[model samples]
Target: MNSFLLALRASPLRWLLVPLVALDLTLILTRDGYWHGLWGDTGAAGQVPTLFLGVFAAAAAAWTSSLRRPSEVAETLGAMPRPGPQAELPRIAVVLCVFLVPYLVGQAVCFAVTASSWPPGFNQYLGYLLLGVASLLTATGLGWIIGRLLSSRWGAAAGALGWLLIVMAFDNDLSVVNGPARMQPDLLEISLRAAAALLLLVACLWLPYGPRITRVSPLPGLTVVLALVATAAAVGNPVIDERHGSRTKACVKGPTEICLWPEEEKYKPMAQDVLARAENLPPVLAKPDAVHSLGLVYTEDRRWGGDFDMDSGSVWAMADGLTMAISAETFAACREKDFKGFEAQLKADDQSVLALERWLEKRLAGGGEPEYREEGMTESMAKAVETGKEMADRPEAEQKAWATATVRNVLGKYCDR
Candidate 1:
């Protein structure tokens, strides 16, 4: 116990904590207010500090290992009663303490702050947090192993490079956190990655150093390490999980039935408020029918609901999403109509629908005429934009007439058949 205390005094972690905490808090607080009150994102924010700290942890671990080689320590022990892991693992624990303590503190503070506003549940997805922890352990262990192997000052730089390479290798696969999306982490991918990291850390723990640490053959361990690396390559992409939501938790609000997901339940009042203000706008294209949450799909009609995100809490975002949802409904209905083989992509690139969307957005959000960018304007798209601007410039009756007739005709033409 006293040895641990003594080690802490000598460790650079004593000084690193202040800067690390400052950096970590900055990451947590600097972003959009949308995520600050949310549970999952805030918990994920807990892992943000380690992305930078992991490299430092690796380099520092390697540097410290070079300073205290187990063989040299064994020599110093001479004929002492106990020699191996008892003498060594504790110091490694000290190294882990240096890096992990700040991580833990940052996590606790983030959660505490988020918990005040989000009452129903905690961060349901812990895979990202676990991923962060495993990465930290892997970096520290790998760095220590590198220094042990090199037993030189250059070990620190090598350790940093190795850690960076590992991060890049898993770069596409690492889906640590997202803002307000309904999609959660892929547990299968997360487990596979977390497992691979653990196995490697186990290999590091069992690694035999010279003649002092272990008498086991290095060949068997090397083979095992190779196997683990190959398995890591097989883990699936983490961030590629689908955008999903539970209809069971869906809540319908306001006159148009804007359904939102469970996490978005808190915004129901605000959504209703926004819908009320936009009442002067034309009736929704898919009026009287439901406008489900962004991810809730109706397979029978192949209707992928509406545009929704955490940003819907903002007044402008809510108005924009409501108009987008109505426009999407029009798009979905048009897809059901038949088009010629050559016009198949028409369903995707329909200009009339874009115009309708922009026009409705202008009315609901109270914007000026829709700006058509000449840079990439196709002839048909320019005509569609012109129609939308004309609609926006018209009076309420003309706007409604345009919405029901012009959009209907356009949908019936190419956007439809």
Candidate 2:
């Protein structure tokens, strides 16, 4: 314990520890996903902070490991029977302990803050987090090995920058925690990486000591072979399962239901309100019965199945969902004719429904067309928005009458044909 404290105070790493922790915490909390309340997204986003953490750890380990003394070998032999460094052991321990505290704290904030918001589901990925910690530990081991071999500060600088470039530019599973993760982590793959890191660290422990071999060593060759296997698996094999179909949904149950991804519970009330307004359509026209978010599993039922952008809480996004819901009702109730390859009539029927949806969207905005989100807005949709603006001056009853007549016209033109 005293050796640990002495090494910490004496090492140059002492200057970096405070800054590293401050910067790490800052990065974690300030990321776009911190307030998202997404269990999977938050878990996946953790890699951002871990990137710097690993780089710093590797650089620090190399910086200290390269420092040598003439009596160090003799002192190591006199101090303990252990094969690893005595003073250097304390240095490694102190470096790891300092960086680990901030990493763990940042992770805890992610879970605790997300849990506070009542996310759709809690997918505890302790294994992925473990893989993150192990990544840093492995980098530290490499730094020491690199420093020991090269014995220069340039090696430490290169190791740090090289680690960053590998993580950002390279798409290796061993280094990347899956960019913008789909939320489903392959536990088996995570475990394999962790096991490989542990093996690498074990080898690192043996590198600075042991009797200089008079003959060629087979152990180094064996380690190289195992690393090749890990590499192929990391690159050639898929390490993550699909994010969809992995979790259940949080539904706003009603005759006109709205179901969103479990992580998007915060938007449920707004989704409910959006669907509820659609329920008030004229009795002559079709109304949606159920609406499911885009993130949910796929279904063939047009009336019951669709996805949404409720994750962003944009009102226009809700309008888009409303458009999908009501359009499904329009198709199912009024029906469509094959036209026997008559593309012109088919296209006209589609335009008629789109016009109805656009006008209905204006109604959903409480009788005035506010600036609707233009993201995914189409040429037909823009025309529909203009149609809504043209009709905005008329009474609500006139608008309802037009919507009802349009549906009836579709039913007559297509259903009767």
Identify the leading candidate in terms of TM-score.
1
**Span of 10 residues, lowest total lDDT, candidate 2:** 208-217
lDDT per residue as tens, model 2, 282-358: 88655576666664656766332355554334556666676767766665634434443235435663566667766
Give lDDT per model, in order. Answer: 0.63, 0.62
My TM-score estimates for the predictions, one after another, are 0.74, 0.70
**Which candidate's lDDT is highest?**
1
Deviation in Å, model 2, residue 26 alpha carbon: 2.4
Q: On a 0 to 1 TM-score scale, where does candidate 2 land against the true structure?
A: 0.70
C-alpha lDDT (0 to 100) for residue 140 of candidate 1: 80
Cα lDDT of model 1 by residue, 157-208, tens digit: 9889988887777773442545344655555666666666556555555455
RMSD after CA superposition, every candidate = 5.3, 5.6
